[model samples]
Target chain A: MKLIGENLNIMSKKYGAALKAKEAKPLQELAIEQAKAGMDYVDLNIGPASKTGVDLMTWLVPVIEEVVDIPLALDTSNVKAIEAGLKACKKHRPLINSIMVRPERMEALLPLAAQYDAEFVGLLWGPEGMPRDENERGALCAELVFKATGEFGIKPERIFVDPIQTPVNVQQIQIMSVLEFMKMFADIAPGCRSTIGLSNVSNGPPDHLRPILNQVMLIILKRHGMYSAIVDTYDTMLHEIARDKHPGLEALVHKVEDGEAVDMTHLSDEERSFVKTAKVIMGQALYSDSWLEI
Target chain B: MTFQPSKQVYSGKIREVTLGSGDKAVTIGGRGVYAFHSFEGAMPNAPRIAMEVWDKDPSEDWAAAAKAPFGDVLADPAAWASKCVKEYGAEIIVVQTKSADPNGDNRAAADVAATVKKVVDSVDVPVIVWGVANHEKDTEVMKLVAESCAGKKVALSPVEEGDYKQIGAASLGYNQLVVASSPIDINLAKQLNILLGNLGVKAENLLIDPTTGGLGYGLEYTYSVMERAGQAALTQEDEKLQQPMIANVANETWKCKESNLSTEDAPELGDAAQRGILMEAVTAVDLMLAGADVVVMRHPEAIKLVRNYIAKMM
Candidate 1:
């Protein structure tokens, strides 16, 4: 899996302080750690960044670039800020974090992406907002992708289609819808790649329980052909699974994903946890705080 | 879009590994494309064929067609290697240390090293010393051979998961290259490469042997594994699995019972010599298509045929 580190966000207490203070050291340190953690890209999620978006991104891109060689995913709602970040990405192709299926976002960002020759994620969330199901996601993908490729002249290879990930606790059905969209992504876009905000699946779950949901969701998404993911830099277990180091665990997850009759008694503690977590994500079992114990 | 072909966009490349030192050193791998998909990306180095030279005379074991070209040189490995380079236009020579097998003559490590050194000395091209895959014997023989042939950049083959530590360390110490052998499984192949990398063997000093199987004998399995390895290296950006692959095609192809079956015994099988040559050539070509950087082949005819195929493809 091509990992895009999701740690360099303004939401992080430590890094958010650094971002607010315009301190390069903490952000650069996180960037280096993420690169060393085997991340293919580092997502600089300056969420919405409406106020100082442009200047902050301009400063931030160069700061991270000073330390690590990885491409930075310029993530923000502010179009001007994305352009500032893209301008600093002279070494590699920077990714414009998202171009929502909505016209306003597409019109603002698509030209910037074309002008900079940058890769951008085609966020499936249309003007109607969060897609109802796989069909809606597919329709949004078609609209955004056709415009990006057909009108804006973006190559299909440069587009990364993100079938938006919803928290498992709230929208368990949407998680399955995302998987269904993944199965259809290649057929829809053909050459375009796919990525996800992997941590979103575990967002509302308890901190202790989050990693399992995220990891199991990753294995399932991978089977459905996820090209890359925006993931935590410190998630070593997730990284190992992505690198295919744990074949037995991957095999067990595949069994669960395949809906095979797996006897819970035959599994070890770790294996049982993964199986149960996968069940919750697949909506085979209902979500609860103490799901693992159950 | 009028039925456009889906082209892969690769983020990683196979590391190019140069074998031998100075003048005749040959480099393989370093491709940003799948096999020979030259239209999409660069295949910097064309696949090379390393002609096989046995450490011991193979009059009894080798098929008649395979032994026909060497003639008098078959008795001496150095002479055989020289013949391969000078007469056959072989760019590389692989000295097969079959006699050192614990099951066979069980030649001492020192004895095999001496013979391998002679072969390395005789050939201007790169020399790859292939061990008999017995973990203990390979470890012993390759350690001495790496030490004896220091600075030659000779490649030590059949370095399995069990023996990578000893052989890998030897390669590291002597600056030799290692051909990490694995079963016909992409996961095993990547695991062995990872193990070698952990032993401080640089990517440029490594080669992957996904264990070749001749035509009609698990060739499809070998092909698929190699295809997957190439896919991972180029598309998935799997750095550990991106070392150029070397298929030990000669041993597997020639040793098959069909290669030895006489025309009189099996009239419908056509000429024995031509059949063996075709099998070897077909297997070599198939492997090259599946992303083999180097194919260790025995017959000159087969090598020439494969060279032609590569010429056309490249």
Candidate 2:
């Protein structure tokens, strides 16, 4: 599985002139921290806050790359920023945050990807906007896969299709769509990858809602063949939740523990055996109270 | 004296059925071993390819290399089908009713039906009728068209969760095959198939479209999903999901500007037509390798390339 770290978390001047005078840690420092924290790739983004706009991405990407050897997931809404970021990136190969199903958007972004030999996240929604229904959305997703592979020469392994996660509060069936889109992606493009913004589904909900939704979604997505995601590296609660849901962690730990038969079928087994193992080895100071204390 | 591979040969959606009388028919879903492991057992029938025809004029953005052959015939579906069969050697013709696009000219159901009838009548091989993406309009348009070609054994697609009832009923009434489209997830794919099954739609009458991605468009993710689904269908033996798979190649292939736009835009990229054809060919090959039973594609060159590959594999 490709490891991904969230981009640009600290309030920085590069984000905007208004934020420039703020005392937040530099973006470069934050990236180095994430790298030291064991992230495989640092997600870099210059959202609406950035003063230099896309120029900041081009400027900061190299600085972050200089400090860390990890690959980058270039996260930006601005096309020019993506281009600049792609140019600035020293990593051999980077993953583009996304190119939605809109033809114009795909036309603009996919060529840049092809030029740089970069991987991309292709969203399912087209110029008409996201379809309200699951089947339609799934069909659109299927269509995007076809376009990405059949029209563009991008390799299947390099592409990651995002099914466009919707907030649970807005639409309940969207949960089903997420699951369905993951399955459809597996069946149609067996070699392609799938991912989503872990934080998107919980947007506008309570702070605690994010972790639970992300973990459940992650487990189902992973089971269905998704192997990568764009998420906050600082969200330890969410990370723990994801760790608990991972299908192979227990098995791997069991192998390490001299093949102890861990009854992974029940939630209690996860609490007793898995949580206990983490606590014993990592110590109370290192481990969070969320998984073990619960 | 002999070398043996570990995995067995299993067919998941897209096996060729041979009748006692020497007639050959294609069916999907049979599992005795893993894919392409003939040493383990009989691995009969490679996947088949379907040529695509649409109602709209071949857009200017289409690669000149691929579009030159179809030139004037691109305007008419019947001419396109005839050209594909006579010139391209297509075994099956897939006609996408793009003229039914609600956002576009919004042609009436009768207009869509007329085109479908013309294409169906023009070809002796089996046909697949794809509805435009609009749900309400597709339901309204496809019903009359499916009825028009009743008992002729056409494949009608894109029956999703919200709209399967109408499309499924239409397919049943017409004695046609229905495609069940699910997103990239496995459980939902299974669930949708199960839902279709509950509606009295036999597994054989259904084709599972798991959705696909092109080369740069998360194709690996799509490949993994399809591979897992195929594995699940065979190893887990989920009855509902053990249907043939269908992928519409042309619709996706033509959309990418790299394939469709002129090479003048990106000189570093060579020959738009060949590039476009190659993209489709690569996508078809990937899907086939990943266990897709049927591929619906555009461009005669791509069709030819896939056919030759299939021949070589056989």
Candidate 3:
């Protein structure tokens, strides 16, 4: 029942410059604040805007590390940026944002993950694209796991598979497919972890809709063995689930995740009492158990 | 000297397309009667339904009626799907890779593969692998997806104008089916079919998807195109366009603000949930009648209504 908290850090090239100019101090401080606020990892993303070939991680990671000791999830589309961050990372074993199923990318990144002895996120689709059905998709997942464990020599426990999230506007069935797949991964590959980016599905809609959808999707993903996700570190909905304080809190969390105004008035005293009771039980059963270890 | 009257025969939307050698073959649904009536005249085995799943989360804008069944399970895919199969009766599950959207998680290929595998393991029903409409990402992810699902016979698709080669080759290599999508234009639909054919993906292995629009958002356009495409398959007998059809009903219906919003916001509106269900149901049935082999939808109530309508019609 102990809630395992993965650091939820949002690191960006935008924040890095802000830190240098002193104007960005708040952004870095914000990330540090998230870590202080109970995030297990602060995600560092040096987006495309950053100068290429320069190792920002070598400099920035230390600064963040100086302020907080939490683990980091090195997130980047650029291989160089990831390497820079990894090189400067203070934590002994940080989580790699991802290594996709593409042969070239996997070949390049898997070794890095192995060399660092880091936990890695493995996407299901490779160079071809997402398949249309579960059987083929499952086969694809098996192949990735095989490569991660057999070829990369990484342990299953260290590998987290991200069943890529598709947009609801286009491929509607994919939403259910992802949740089913998450469950399948958990059942089939118990040693490995499952996770996803929490904000991808509601990409095109009104801004308010995103969080509610995310919360609902997260709960589905969590039930299906998704142990972690790359989400806004400060999201209350996420905190509710991670804390396991209220099982029904998912309804409210989903509303918030979707950007809907949460009306606590809907809950009766009985429901409110249930949430309080659940929170106490969850804290005692899940969180309190791990306090001593931490 | 008495004369007997013939009964009005109705057909379902499920169709089965058989390809390859005995037992080592693939069977995909194309059950709508209008598609290829000359062959079997349409009894059962109409097109299947693909349920929706998202990469991030489904928004609250979803009609309360649609969201009600999902309840607590709405948050998790595995739990939701299990309910769909066990409770709601989903025949085939389609996992849309929406997270692959470039603006979103822009998740890598391995993530797509993992998710596909997870759903495959969750149920006995077949699963569909879908891309998030990013041609570049689809090309990148599907190859790994095809390779990962090798010999499993999953359907990978919506292989549109610019990126058919990558998806086609991957599907062909994996021995899975490909969904060839085109705008509502019948000629364009046929052209895409021909393009898929040229790629060496057989007609039987192809599922034709003429893009769908929801109620009030040009459903008539979709209906006309689908009907024309179906008529072409039946009367004109165009082999290229004769393949099964897949229509996404839930995506379009849910997008209609009328279906998801509260009636209180619009007093003229009837029951919003019922309206949403009706929109999806009507769209699904209309597509089926128009010759859709597969009707992918969201709301369970809508699915039930469609199923019952198909039952009554057949």
Candidate 4:
């Protein structure tokens, strides 16, 4: 699985302070570490940089580029800031962190993405906001792809469609909806890659139990042909599972996905936790902060 | 509308592994696409054949045609290996240590190591020492073989899950290559490669043996697993499964009843000689298509047939 580092975000407390101060050291250090951790791309999530969006992106893009060799995903709500970051990317192909399915966002960002010849993630959030089900996601994907490829002349291969992951604790039904959307994504927009904000699944869960949900969800998503994921690069075990170095764990998760009656007594502690977490995501078991304890 | 062919864009490439050393070293596995899909991407190294030479004389049980080419040197593996290289144009020689099997001659590890060294010295090309599947015996014999041919870069085959530690350490200590063997399952194959890597086997010093099965004898299973291995290496970009694969086609193909059953015993099966050669060639070709980097083959005619097929395909 291709990993887009989600650690260097403007939302993190330390990095957010550093971004506000325009400090380059902390961001550069984190970028280098993420690349060493085998992140295929680093997401520069300068969330809604409304005031200093353009200047922060223009300055930060080159700052991060100078430190790491991997590509950068320019993430922001500011249209001009995205274009500025795209212009500043000299070393690698830049990915526009998102272009929403909404008309105003598409009209503003699609042409900028096409002009820069940049790859963009197609976020399946319609004008009414978050799709009701897989069918709604599918319809939004068709409209976004048709405009991106048909009108802007952008190729499908360059677009990554994100079905928008929902937290498993409160939005368990949407967990299955996104998976259903992923199953039909290729048919809807052939050659378009897919990614997800993997941490979203565990958003409402306790901090200590978040990695388990993310790891299990990653394996389940990969089985359904997820191309990439925006993930916590520092989670060593999660990356190991992504590289298929832990087949035993992946097989246990697959067993839960396949609906096999797993004998819990025979599993190791880690394998048993993976099974439980997968069941929660599949909605076979109720979600709780102490699910692993159960 | 233009007819645009839907070609898969692979994000990974197989790590190239070099066998032997000096002038005659052969490198395999550096392809960015599936085996023989050169039109889509680059397959820099073509699949090769390493003819097999057994440690013990097998004229008693061997079919007449399989035995005909090396009749003069059947008793001596060094001589047999020389004949394969000097006459038949073999690029690599695989010394099958049948004598070390505890159920067979039960030869001492020292004796087998000497035989392997002799064969390695006799050939200009790379030598691969194949062991009996018994873990304890292969560990003992291959450790000595690794020592005897230190720095020669000869490969130790069938270094399985049971003996990867002992043999993998010896290969690292002596600068030899290891063929990581597993049952015909893609998961087990990747797991073994991961184990070997954890044991410090570098990417260039490893080969995958997914446990070959002959035509009509679980060939489909082996083929599918190999194809999956190829896809995982190139498309899924799974680092552990990216090593070039080596299929022991000769051992599996020649031993099957379809290759050995005489026409008198089974009249409808046709001539035993031609049938065995075709079976070996067909199995080798099928395996190459499914991503075999090197196929251990028997019978000069079968080798010739496979060479022609590879040449035409390339």
Candidate 5:
């Protein structure tokens, strides 16, 4: 299982600015913290570095590589940037952010992965945007496996399939679709592993509720063969909950994921619920004595 | 497309495992594709057969068909091994530690090492020294055999998870190949290989035995599992399972009740000798198709049949 640290990326301007100026202190801090938290790879996404993507990557690769001993996941769709970062990477099995079933993405990234001897994340979507259901997602994933392995000659185990997880607020049933794809990832490509963009489920949800939603979805997806994740490794709660704290959690998560009532008698309604920690954090739950116990 | 074969593109080669030192060495595996699937990928080394010979003579208990080929040399393992490499066309020799079983002669490790030395000197083709499935006794005997055959690189067989540390340490110290054996489970098989690697055994010094299942008795299960391991080796680049595989098919087939029965009782089965030989041959062929790199078998006729089958395919 690969626990990827995905905090330092171009999604936020704070992170973007840090990479733009080749800032080392803040990035080094994140790398050391993620490395201490048992992350297999610290993902480096340079979305704001788009214009100078290749240049920024060439600069940031050695900066992060100097401080962190763990491998770095080069998070970008830019081919030149990925190659630049890969060249700068030394003694690390740098993991590529993604490729897809689309002709351009597959033809470009798959061969790059083979040439650089790197593991890659194959996104389960083409240029036409994300799949609406689990079946299409699976089909696309299978196509990714078929081409990456059958054509590009990359090892199946080296490829990690990303079943695109969008915000549940936008696509309510997406939670189930991604989970279902994770369940079938093994059969799609026997030795291949599944990964999810952790924060995607919380994209439209409230800022305070994001981590709770992300953590819950992570636990649920992990049950269905989700091994690797593009996750914020600094979230102590996410790391804590990853171990499967409660026994009936799986059944409860499944029931809720399937949009059915949990039949487990052992757990309380709040305990079986998805937004427990979020409600507590937002002061919606009364400060009862047994509140922390649950 | 000519109803084309299912082709898989793989970059990882099953580690070409070499046995014996200097001039006598023979390599197995080193193919980048599934066994005999040359319509797509290259199978560099044609799978070899290692004939089995026991240290002590079995005058009567031996299956009539099995004993017929080497009737005179049965008393002396050296002569038997010599005959296998010399005449019967054995590419390699397998010396079983069956007599070392506590139920049988219970020969001590030192005594067994002397016999091993005799066979080692008799045959130039590399030897495989296998133990009774017993963990403690096998550990002792295999370690002594490792010491006796130091620098010779004879493959030491039946290195189970329980006794891996001892056997692995010996292989590491003596610089020999270790046969990482597991009970028909791919995961268990991979784990043993990983443990052996951690014990300093090089990838080239490893061979996998995925515990061969006999014909008509869960042979399909072995086929699927072996196929899975081979796929992992080639496509997944799983170094643990990515080494030559040796199937003790003859031993498994011989132990089955179907192969041992005389035609007098089961007369419908036809000639007992021919039936037994076919059973061994068919099992070896099935194992080869399932990505076996070296097949350890008994009987001259089965060896010839398997060899001929391999020749036509190659």
Candidate 6:
């Protein structure tokens, strides 16, 4: 499984200096920690720097790249900013993160991705809206895969598909959609890899609760064949759990992926409540106790 | 969809274990697929034989088939072992400690150790010290045998459920390879392996004996058990069942009634000597295909036939 550090985005803007004269100490620290925690790639997302997006990404890519040689995901809403970061990444090619089904952005990004020989990331969303069901997401992903191979000449193996995760608080159906999309994505594009911006699923939740939400979602998502994850690589607990692999965790993940209720009687009351919340979000069963102890 | 054979992908590999330190050493296992699935996996080391050399005298009350080839060396184990390696090109020598059996002469441990020492000093090839079925007697004899061949790196046998701690401790102390012997039960075999591991036996210092049965004597059950153990090692990635296996083919085949009975006694059964040799040979070759890495056998003709079979298979 590939772990991507997602700490250097607009979520922590104070660490991103104007000209990087203040040494960008926090940015370097997070990169080092993520790399040490066995993250195969570090994500450098200077979110929405419209006026200075290109310059900030260009400066930040090298600062993180200078410390760790692992691959970086050049994430930005603007296509030009991703291109600027691509130029600065000297040694290892960066995976472009990411593009939707918008034609204009796809035209600018896919060719640059092919020209640089870098792997690309594509989302399930199009110009109209995000897909509401599994086959809808699968059809959209299959279209990108066909175009990625036939039009741009980028190999299917090089593209990483992100199904565009939605927070369960807003719409619960998306949890099942994400799992189904992940399960079906491999068959849709045989050699392509499946990934998720894992922290987004826990968005808007309390900070203390976010870790459990993110980790549990990752566990279930992995069972559905989500091989790559963009997470807080600095969280030592995630690394510990990953290293100490357990059969029970896989059993629970398997049950959740199958959309069946798991036997959570062995877990603590608090842990079971969290799992119960997950069952509600995953649509495996109807919500019973909203006043549950989570 | 077009039909395609699903390729087997495994997460674990058999540990390659070597006995006898230097040039004449033999290593087995380490393949990641079924016995001869060389197209998908590696088969690095070829299977070898450990020719039998008995501690008791072979002349008295022994079958004529076994005594024909080893007539002169029957009384002397060292001479028999030397003839096995030098004349027949046997890969390893197995000194069967039959004299130490309680029902028989019940020879002292020192006597068994002395014969083992002579065989070890006589043969350049690696030696395997097989104990009699008596647990307490084998523990006593193997302790002495382990001291006799300290640095020779011999393989000690019959480390069963009851005597694993005793035999396992002796093997560890002397740095010898301990064969985890179990009945024709895969679970018992795996459990005994776990016990040996708990006794501090490294993966590289262990062997498996699923207990051989002669041809027409429940050989199918033995074959199935061995096949299942191989599947666990290669496909399912169970580490404990991964060690190379051995079967005392000569012991089971020679003692069978069909092989030992003469034409006069049972005229329907043809030549007793010829039938005996074929029985051992057939049992040995079948076990090899069923994933036995080492086979201990009598009769030079039987050994030759098995060698020819392995030549084509390996």
lDDT of 4 by residue, A1-294 (tens): 999999988889999999989999999999999999999999999999898999999999999999899999999999999999999999998999899999999999999889988999999999999999999999999999999999999989889999999888668779899889888988999999999999999897778888999999999999899999999988999999889999988888889888898999988898899998998798665564556764
Consecutive 10-residue window with the lowest summed lDDT within model 3 chain B: B6-15
Q: Across residues A93-157, which tens digit of lDDT does each residue of candidate 2 receive?
A: 88888788887888899889888889898877777887666677677767776776778777888
Ranking by TM-score: 4, 1, 5, 6, 2, 3
Measured by C-alpha RMSD in angstroms, how accurate is candidate 6? Answer: 22.5
**Worst ten in a row by lDDT for model 1 chain A:** A285-294
Which consecutive 10 residues in model 2 chain A have the weakest lDDT in total?
A280-289
Candidate 6: tens digits of C-alpha lDDT, residues B1-314:
99988887765577888877678988887777777667787888777878998987867656887798888888889999999898889888898999998898988888888989999999888988999867899999888888778988898898898898988898889899888888887756876787777779998999999988889998998998898788767765566778998888998998889887887897888888889999999998888889888889888998888888878877
The lDDT per prediction is 0.89, 0.68, 0.66, 0.91, 0.81, 0.80
Docking class of 4: incorrect
Better of 2 and 3 by DockQ: 2
With candidate 1 superimposed using the best TM-score fit, by how many Å does residue B4's alpha carbon deviate from the native?
A: 3.6
lDDT tens per residue, model 6, A85-121: 8898997978998978678778888998888888878
TM-score of each: 0.56, 0.53, 0.47, 0.56, 0.56, 0.53
lDDT of 5 by residue, B1-314 (tens): 47975667885779888988878789989899989988777888999999999888876666788888999999999999999988987889999877888878899878887898889989888999988878888898988989988988999989998999999999999899989898887656766777777778999999999898989887887887799788777875666678899999888888787787888978988888998899999999999999998888989999999999999999
lDDT by residue for model 2 (B72-187), tens: 79888898898888888777788888778889778898888888899988877777788876788889877987788876777777778778888888877866788888776554
- Candidate 1, residues A117-199, lDDT tens digits: the string is 99999888888899999999999999988999999899998999999899886677799899888888888898999889999
* Model 5 iRMSD vs. native: 21.9
Q: What value does the lDDT take at residue A243 in candidate 4? A: 95
CAPRI quality level assigned to candidate 1 from its DockQ score: incorrect
Q: Looking at model 3 chain A, report the run of 10 residues with the lowest lDDT sum.
A: A284-293
Ranking by lDDT: 4, 1, 5, 6, 2, 3
Candidate 2: list runs displaced more than 4 Å. A1-294, B1-4, B8-31
For model 5 the TM-score comes to 0.56
Give the winner by lDDT: 5 or 6. 5
